[model samples]
Target: MAFSQQLPQGVTDLYADDYELKQALTGQLQHVISSYGYQPIQTPTFEYYDLFMNVPGTMNSDQMIKLIDRDGKVLVLRPDATVPIARMVAQSQSEVETYNKFLYVTNIFRMESGESDRSSRSFSQVGVEWFDDAHPLNDIEMIVMAIESLKQSGLKNIQLELGQAGFFQSLLQEAGLTIEQQLVVQQKVDEKNEYELSRLLTQYQVNDQIKNQLIQLPSLFGSPNYVITEAEKIAVNRGMKQSLKRLVELVNQLEQLGYAHYISIDLGLVNHLNYYSGTMFQGYIEGYGKPIIQGGRYDQLTKYFDLETSAIGFGIYLDDLISIVKKQQSFKTNQLETVDVVTEEKDFVKAMEFAQELRGKGVVVNMHYENDSTTGDPVIYLSEKKVEIKGETFTFTTVEDFLTKAGFKNGNN
Candidate 1:
């Protein structure tokens, strides 16, 4: 492809050795997932629209990259991987145990053609989903694994912010607001506009106690203990208690993980994903300025695929991870040597043999005979009688002497 056909904007070609960086992050994330017994999984980059649309916060048809199949049915590039993965787990699994854990890394496409403030329209997300597990311990484990994954990825100065979706949802349920009013409150929460939430709650007619509680929800963020202390003071109706208890148990387990220092609770965080029916959380690194990882318990998510189970999990935003690693002072980009072996057809057999020999010893070798010696900053010139490697030239009376000089002891020798 010519440079004229290069990507328009917000997209970059990885000309540098980004593979090493990606491999480091992938290996660490997979290590944590494996230690936690979560299996790796993959799904198609495009799927039937019906799969994701069942869940809210999924982009509309216009926002997705929609295409028509030969049969005239609509197909979409997967905006997110979790939904397709959930569909797969539900339809593919026949186990009676009713518990499943999965981890995946995939690209998510979005319509950001006109957006400013953001550079890329297409981004990558890494996340995990668990099906049919409702225990509070399940939520805590997910958060801990997120912390572990980041730390294992060589990141520090990270914070884990926990939020209970049910907390705010229960409050809204009791607020007696019309669906429209509830939407107003939700919009405020999504925007993190606390002043509007307060003004609206005060003006609206509702139970004063509930109004005050709802108003306070937006400001309810602090250490887990502090947030829980405030949360317990709220009227503990049956619905409220269920959500509160889950939060408490999750915090207790998180404390046990010795990660309580990195943990905070934000009662205001309402994830866009509605299927996250229970505890929802996000991971943040200092310089990333956005959630580097996001996952939560989505109990109702599997039901869309005809499986009924309580589940929760998270996705690691790999692009976000790379961004953070880029900012972090400790993370270093590795430099690797590039070798291009030039040989004529007469020397091709010997070149092949030498290349295989270098490969077996774990050297990164590139065999190309046409490289302009003047252009390569470092060059290697090889011949049967002499070898010039990295500006040093050595002549040998024969190939046997050359091999001996290079310390290549032939197995057949």
Candidate 2:
């Protein structure tokens, strides 16, 4: 098979309007996250494969794209930003601080299952990680930012489904399920397969009361007020009770902040990443199949690197997000109009000077010789004796007259 004209599966090139739209989306996200005091940071594009292997539940090894270094060490394209960021924070600080916040815009590489052409193996992500903050306010702040991010992206009809990992982890502990059994239950619950979940619980001969609550887990989703009330009734132990309390507080605060309409509860919401230790949530917009925004508390992630502080953050799948933005026609790209300067060879020097002047005033300028076809808006035809703009011809004089006639007064477009 010839490969000259083909790109590898699951990768793509962004050009023209698509590329500009992506840039616009990225800039909006950066502005929104930065306003929350998150300074930008970056990690290497590749890291030692062991960095992920050492942290169980970080990512499936099969999904990571790997290569061998010259010295025979194995490396992988950065599959996740959170893991590498956590590693960096752990290695840099002698002692964990009370608060640390950072943001990043980078690409992650991973292999997708199923049809390769239908899925992306590489894509950009915009996200932030907050370290050493476990207060419910921290979780609330993350959720609020996630909501604001989608809203700022020009997405309407957004929903943020909130959950707590501890809610179900506690239920599993109370059921006394082994590691293997717990994984199976989590998968079923995440799938919302009540029948399979019930059959599995019955097969394990779980206590009737606990089994019933386990079956109820998948259905424990809806308005926070209703879900919290129902979840309290099924609270089997203190762990389950505490998880509900924390979620209530978060929802209440969000409600107070006027974001109640965007909040929903999903007790069965399970993140693929194992680092999450507490509050977890995902943001979605109408018509998208997957969550555009995902985040949660992972107080245990840094401990693997010997830094015991708490951490929580979220990542927005930028490629998928831009697609949604394009479909909704919600985000309008501020396409800059270019001014083309067409001139004869003899007038080239003067045309160049005029082009530079327009550029200095923040206008986009493209220089063109007389015969060259022009594509930009507001074409300017300059010659020794005449200046023509928009079909209005003026006898060539001082640059100021042309500037004023072009509607660029005092450098303000």
Candidate 3:
């Protein structure tokens, strides 16, 4: 096997228009996030292995790419931004204010065991974390921002399905299921496999009342009004009731904001990350089967770092986003036009001067000696007294006259 010619599985190289379009999408999302007061921040590409290993629910250890440092400390490529950002916030708790907001566009590396071609071991994520604010309004703000960010990326027909992790967790506790049993049930519910979920609940010999509710979990999704009303009827315990109340508040507020049309409910929409302690949501664009955005409230994650702060955040799968945007042709790349300048050896210095001037005026200029093949829009033939553009030749007395004759208005074509 030739290592040089082959990229590792689940990785890819991006170039040309694809890369430019990805950048354009990222910029649009960043602008949206920043507009909401999220200041950009970055974490190292790798961190000590224990940083993640110690934090259960962050990610599976086996999925992490690891290495050993000189002193024999284990390190893993950063698999998640939220966890590390939480760690950073905790470490700087004394220095910074109690509340903070951060945004990031970073790469995440992890091993995907068995995934489709759409899955990449390395991918970029655009996300934001709001710290120390657990009010329902904060949750509303995050969801609103998520919708706006997706719209900014030129995605229409977007649907954000909201769920409550606490609601599901409360039901699990009432069912008295062991950790292993809980995982099996959670997977079935997350998949919306009601048949399997019913079989599992019956096998566990869960209480008749609780088992009935568990069986209906998969079907507990639709419009916010319908799901919420139905979920209230099954509210089995205090925790479940409280979680539902939070959902109600969020839905009411979102409706007032005129975003109810974009909102849906999914009581069974459980996130694989165990850190989520409250509302969990995912955004899907029409025609795309997988979610482009996912997030939730994980008020307890910072406690693992010895800080008691509430937080919520989401990551937009940039690779997936780029694919959808390209398919829709919704986003236009702000690619600059390149102009090629052709000149003789004796006039090279003059050509260089003219090229710099054009560049200063916001045009992309490429220099070429007359015989050199050029690859740019609008080739310019520069000599002592004549100028040529688009097969039309003319004589100009000054650079300003040349600019006017070439039809460069306001420093650009």
Q: What is the lDDT of residue 280 in candidate 2?
A: 95
The TM-score of candidate 3 is 0.93
Ranking by TM-score: 3, 2, 1
lDDT score at residue 126, model 2, on the 0-100 scale: 95
lDDT of 1 by residue, 105-223 (tens): 78887666563223565776767777754866666777778888888788989898888888888878988898668867876886678788878887777778887787777778888
Candidate 3: global Cα-lDDT? Answer: 0.86
For every model shown, the clashing-pair count is 9, 0, 0
- Quantify all predictions' global Cα lDDT against the true fold: 0.73, 0.85, 0.86
How would you encode candidate 2's per-residue C-alpha lDDT over 1-413 as one tens digit per residue? 85598889889999888988998899999999999988888999999999999997888889999999999999999999999999999887763463388999999999978643227889899999999658778888888889999999999899999999999888889888887788788888988999999999999989999999989999989998789989999897899999989988888899999999998999999776778889999988888888888999999888899987888999999988888988899998766546677788787788788878777766777777854645636666675445556667666456577666667655544
Worst 10 residues of 1 by lDDT: 404-413
For residue 221, give model 3's deviation from the true position in Å. Answer: 1.5
lDDT of 1 at 138: 66
Q: What value does the lDDT take at residue 233 in candidate 3?
A: 93
Relative to the true structure, candidate 2 has a C-alpha RMSD (angstroms) of: 2.6
**If the candidates were sorted by their lDDT against the true structure, best first, what order would they fall in?**
3, 2, 1
Cα deviation in Å at residue 159, candidate 2? Answer: 1.0
TM-score: which candidate is best? 3
Candidate 1, superposed: residue stretches over 4 Å from native:
1-10, 56-58, 96-99, 112-119, 199-208, 329-346, 367-379, 384-413
